[model samples]
Target: MAEIALCFAAMALRGFGGVLGHSYDILVVRRQWLSEREFAEVYGIGQLVPGGNIINVAAILGDRWAGLAGATAALAGLTLPSTLIAVALLGLASKLAGEPHVASAERAVVAAAAGIVLASGLRTLRTIREAGRPRLVAARAAIAAFACAIACVPFVGLPIAVIVATPLAFLLERRAAR
Candidate 1:
């Protein structure tokens, strides 16, 4: 229990913005707890759930390994430290809200986070290709999904855009698979 908590806590700390992507590294490369395919399987399950993929990942991974106790431990470890840090940062941001540089810094941080997310995705695609899915249809679907999301973000908003694009993307996948 302690070890599971510690590992997930470390994963959260190390992952920051790209938790799922980083999980591939920490779990597969470092811990050897899961192989590349298993990591993909776990992450696919995480995506199937509604809320945050990373949170679902921690819970599912915990449950898979050690049942309820593991789930609790992993969730607590992932949330507690991150929550405390987020609260402290939010408080600080509120105090600094009027400063021009603070706003700029926030944009920069958000931009960096987006870059990390992009890189994580690229890494995942590369992994899938390396794992023998190199036919390029998945890549095309990803590009289409991304383009649709970009267009839809201004039209319908992000959440609805994602909701809409997801099924379209899946359909594209089904087509690609055939």
Candidate 2:
């Protein structure tokens, strides 16, 4: 119970704009608490549900660890502090909205967040490379990247890209399996 609370509190402390992606990956993959596949499953389910992804993750982990009681504890640990901090920051931002220095600091934070995203991408790529299934890994990476890029364009259907790429990824994996 204490450990679960500590884990969530630590996650809450590190929570910043868009930092959850890197944090989730690190906790699920690097820490060996969950497999990449398990993380993907939980994340996918979270996306399908109503709440925020990180909060959903907390709930899922809590449920896994200690059932309903655990889930409630994890939710409280993960959300309360961050929610309070965010509300305080929002109040401060309203006061500082017209300040040039505040605006500059906000821009700096945005840039830092972008850097973190890039670093997380690189780390994921490194993990794929180290998985010892180079051919399948490379093929999936290429397909996923192409699909993602195509999905970004207006009027291009994201589902189409997934439909086209899934078979290619499967074929590549099958070949690698042999």
Candidate 3:
């Protein structure tokens, strides 16, 4: 239980704008708690759920390990550290909001976060290919490209884009599986 809490707590600290990449590194690569396919499946379910994806994953993983208690520990570990830091950073950001350096730092962080997400995607793609689903790469990439394009459209928004893209992705997957 303590280990689960510590694992998520560590992930929380490294989390910037997103933590999916960090989650993969810690849970899959470093800790070896989950395999690539397991992480991908967990992450997919996490995205489908209503709340934050990583948070959902933490809860699920915790529950899988130690039932309700594990879930509680994981959630606390994943949220508490980051929440406290965010509060402190919020106060600081308010104070430094007008500073040029802060603006530059924000841009840099955004870029880094984007890079992390892209890398995570690539890693997942590789995992899919290696999992004996080699034909999925082109289909998955096309779906990703379509989702990205849809997300960039004015007022289209991520939710709508996801809604639009999901069935298409499912269809493509089904076809590819055949």
Alpha-carbon local distance difference test for all models: 0.78, 0.76, 0.86
Model 2 gets an lDDT of 0.76
C-alpha TM-score for every candidate: 0.64, 0.61, 0.64
Q: Which tens-of-lDDT digit does each residue in 53-79 have in candidate 1?
A: 889989999999999999999999888
lDDT at position 89, candidate 1: 89
Candidate with top lDDT is: 3
List the candidate 2 regions with Cα displacement exceeding 4 Å: 1-7, 14-57, 131-138, 154-171
Which regions in candidate 1 have their CA more than 4 angstroms from the true location? 48-50, 113-178
By descending lDDT, how would the candidates be arranged? 3, 1, 2
Give the range where candidate 3 is weakest over 10 consecutive residues by summed lDDT.
Answer: 125-134
Q: Judge candidate 1 at residue 93 and give its lDDT.
A: 88
Give one clash count per candidate, in the order shown. Answer: 0, 0, 0
